[model samples]
Target: MIAGLTWLVGFQLLGELVVRVLDLPVPGPVVGMLLLFAYLRLRRYDDSGSIVIAGSGLLRHLQLFFIPAGVGVVAFASVLGRDVLPVTVAVLGSWFLGLVVVGWTAVGLERLLGRPRDDLGDPPAEAAA
Candidate 1:
């Protein structure tokens, strides 16, 4: 358990480093989790490796991970109840708007770069042939 906690902290720091350097939009800890997940997936283990066995314990007690969050929910019940809809709307609306902006930016970028949008157009390189 102590080792796992240390590992988590180290990974989190590593994530912050990458996020800061890359200027990623997502949170650092989220990037760390993605890095850890990618590492776990890439690990080559022997057939008799115990990684699976070790992971089973964490999976079994996954609900325990949410205990602190549950406590927060209880402690803030009144505040949550009072502003739930506003909070939900703000978060959801921001996420939707972000998606829209990102989509539009991508389309604008593709057009600016002159990438062919469809098969109906001859390849730009071939047009000079």
Candidate 2:
């Protein structure tokens, strides 16, 4: 577990270093995750690998990671309240846009792949009834 955690942190640090040096616009953690994914793909580690075990352990307690974000929101409550209208509009607008884009993409992919929508298995018994 320690080794796995170390590897994870090491990759993150390496990512940070690369980003800083290259003046990247992306977050360091995102780059680190991509690097880790590439490494895993090339190395082909099994489920029992230390990295996988550590990652699973972290995922099991994923909710704990949200604490900081919650605290930040509370700290910025006043600011958020002042900009609530814009924030709400931005959030809802983005959500609607994403939904439309994803729906269109799914339909496009389905057509491109020659997969008919009706071929999706039978509906639930309750729905059929």
Candidate 3:
């Protein structure tokens, strides 16, 4: 478990260092996750399953991570209330944009993979016949 924790933190720290040194726009943790993924893909885990154990342990307490955010919202309730409209617009606009991008990506992937297009609402030709 300790080893796995070390591996995770080590990657994150390395990622942070890389980002700072390169002055990249990407978040450190995201880079760290990619590094971890690459490492896991290239190497097999030990029989002790330290990585899985550590990961599950961390996940078990994931809610703790959000406590600060919740507290902040309560702390700044008045400020947030004043900016509610703009915040709502930003959130909804981003969500709609994400949906559009995802739809386009799915269409592109389907064409690239030579898969049949989805026709969820339309009746099949055999059924129509």
Candidate 3's residue-wise lDDT over 1-129, tens digit each? 888899789999989998999999999988998887788778875545777789789989999999989998778878876789999899999999999999999999989999948679778899989
Q: Candidate 1 residues 86-117, lDDT tens each?
A: 99999999999999999789878989999736
Score residue 19 of candidate 1 by CA lDDT. 94
Tell me the tens digit of each residue's lDDT in model 2 across 20-91: 999999999889999999999999988999899998898899899999888997788787767899999999
Candidate with top lDDT is 2
Q: Comparing 1 and 3 by TM-score, which wins?
A: 3
Query: How do all models score by TM-score?
Result: 0.44, 0.79, 0.70
Cα error, residue 102 of model 1, in Å, equals 19
Where in model 3 is the C-alpha error above 4 Å? Answer: 46-48, 115-129
What are the runs in model 2 whose C-alpha is more than 4 Å off?
81-83, 115-129
The per-model lDDT (C-alpha) reads: 0.78, 0.91, 0.87
> Which residue pairs show collisions in model 2?
none
Clashing pairs in 1: none
